[model samples]
Target: MRAIIQQFGPALESIALEHYTPASLSSSQIQLKMRFSTMNPSDLITISGAYRSRISLPFIPGFEGVGIVHQCNEQDSAFSIGDRVLPIGSAGAWQSYRNIDERWCFTVPNQLSDEQAATSYINPMTAWLMLSERLQIQQNMTVLINAANSAIGLMLVRMLNHLGIKPIAIVRRDNTLQEFEGCKLQRIININNRDDYHSLIKMKHHIKVDAILDCIGGGESLMLSSLLKEHGQFINYGLLSAQPIPPQFWLERPDINFSYFHLRQWIHSAEKIDIQNKLNEVMQLVYKGIADTKISARFSLKDIHSALNYIQTNEETKKGKILLTF
Candidate 1:
């Protein structure tokens, strides 16, 4: 079987394709023939050794993928030879085949294409949990989203619209405003311009920000916190800027509630049945075109270096997710 291995060092230099033999499955495990996986920011971060504590060395690097059941242990009655499933939670998804426990895999909805199902789990689920579960946002309320041009950001905007809530997309560039062309929203703020802050402050008087979905931490987070209505909630999910929320910022925001969310932690804490139910709800929305991912590009496993380069160079301008096909 061919796999992308992260030997050591930076993403491009450390990652390479190599042949390897997959271990025989245990009685509760099933073998998956990988169809497609995505190149998420976390994957690159893991390869760069930033997530060294969670990831062991010399391992296959992908976190999620859609695959067909090629071989299954006879005792594993939950899966069959031809089922299309998402083998999530475990690493080593950037390979031709993977042997995973049957319990960890979920059947993909027929309404979703292979490409859509391949990139499903992480981003959509994160958006769903934040809006529906974590914050429990009600209709007619206004919410602010930082990094609103990202894949997850786009999903959040769509989800907010579906629930009849107002979305305030805060972006860094003027060109990003073009991406939200057809989406209904309260306002789009380009914080790159100093004048925009003055406009934002004035708008806050009429529009009470109920919550803030912040992906970029540091100064940007502090800025968003200031915009929140009294007792408003702020959920920080990503540190795209690689900066932490300063201690002083948290200390001063006594009227605002702040919390952090991580998908892995949520998955680990929830029951399997609960996770599946949430996934079903999100997928149903996706089937209706309410919440969906945009595909930026696709690459074969051999061309992973090119894919990494594209993500690195076009991080700001890329419109959607990047996939890796086996």
Candidate 2:
């Protein structure tokens, strides 16, 4: 088997393709032949030594991937040999083959292509959980999402639109707006807009949102909070800005409440049936073309270094995702 090995912390050059013997499948596990795997900001952060967890060095790096089941144990009969499945929450997906617990693998719907399922889980599930669990939103309610150009952000936009809800997008660059030009968005605002912070607040007051999905922390979190209506929720799911929100801001805004969303936390805490039902709902929407995954680039496992280099250098213009294809 071949895998993207991170012998050192997540430096671009530190990741390399290495050959390893395949492990025997556990009684409750399945051996997967990977076909596609997508990169996330966390992958970059992990390699760069910026991730918070204490990851063991020399471990494989990858979280989401699409593959076919080559071997499975009878402990779970949900899938069969050659069945297309997607690995979620399991790391080391950046490999030719992976042995994953059967519970971590989900049968990919026939409607989704290998490429689409490859990038599933992290982004799509995050988006679904945000809308379904975190916000407790109702149809026709509005929400504001920062970093609207992100893969997860776009998924939220599509899901909200399909539900008859509106999504207001906040982006940093004018070019980012072009990606959602034809999107069924309620509003799109560039943070660099001439509208002062006060004007931005007044604008939000007109069409108040039920919640705010803020990926950009730091001062941006404070700004987004100021726009929230009374009792409206604020979900912080990412920290792309790499800056922490000042304590004073939260103290100053006593009326605004804050909640953090970690996809794993939500999934593990929820009922199994509920999780599967939500995932199925999102998958159905995707099958109907109400949502889609954009593949920005594809690379082989041997070219892992080159792939990381491209992602690190071109983070902004990297529309969709950079995936590793086996």
Candidate 3:
């Protein structure tokens, strides 16, 4: 199998594509013929040695993939030889094949294509958990999302619209406003220009916000918390800016609530049955087009270096996920 290996992390150009044998497929495991893989922001961090998890040298690097089961152990599983599945893992996803535990592999809805299913697990699942589970959003309530041009951001916007709620999209560039032009949105604000008081005016003009979903953490997180209604909730799911939320920001506001979310940790903590059930709910939404997993760009497994570079330089235009297809 051809896999992207991090011999010793530096720039993405340093990642080497090489052949390797997969682990043994036990009675409880299945071999997946991977078709597509998604490039996440965390993938960059993992390769650069800045992420919280430390990976040893000469390791395959990819976390989520969509593929077909070529070989399956007949160990009372829900999967079959020809079933299309999404394999969620911490690494070894950027390859031609992956051997995953049957319990960790999930069957995607028939409506999604191979590419859509490939990018499905991470962003859409996070968006669903942020709104449906973590925040417990209700009808007519308002939510705030930073980096609203992203795939997850777009999905959250659509989900809120479906539930008769509102999403206030906070974007950095004026050009991104066009992406959500036709969609039903609460408001659109340029973060650099909008002040807390000014954003409060905009929030009041559109709708009273009940929650915040922040991916761009740093000073922006503090400002986002200000827009939330008194006693409202705030969930930070990513640190695209690679900075932490200050403790004083939440301490100063006694009425507001703040928390952080990580999908991998949540998955690890949950029972296998529970994780699969939650993933099914997220996939169903994607199948119905209530939420979409748009592929903004595609790259080959061999050209991962250029793919990483594109993600860095074209953050705005690359509004959705950058996928690697086999």
Instruction: Give the clashing residue pairs of candidate 2, or none.
Output: 10-47, 10-48
Task: Show model 2 residue runs off by greater than 4 Å.
Answer: 4-7, 52-54, 74-76, 175-177, 196-198, 204-207, 315-318
Best candidate, TM-score: 1
When sorted by TM-score, best at the front, the candidate numbers are: 1, 2, 3
Residue 99 of model 3 has an lDDT of 81
Candidate closer to the true structure by TM-score (higher is better), 1 or 3: 1
Clashing pairs in 3: none
Span of 10 residues, lowest total lDDT, candidate 3: 1-10
Local accuracy of candidate 1 as per-residue lDDT tens digits, 59-150:
88888779999998656468779989988787878999998888788888998999878877888889999888888577678889987877
Q: Per-prediction TM-score, please?
A: 0.95, 0.90, 0.89
Count of clashes, each model? 0, 2, 0
Comparing 2 and 3 on TM-score, the stronger one: 2
Instruction: Order the candidate numbers by lDDT, best to worst.
Output: 1, 3, 2
lDDT of 2 by residue, 1-326 (tens): 46554565555667766677789977878888998888776777776665436676667788888899888864566888899987776468888878888777777788888887776677778887777676776867778888887777878888888677778888776766567755787777878876734566788657676788888889899877777778788889988788877796578677776888888787777775676777787677667765667777888878877777777787642457788888
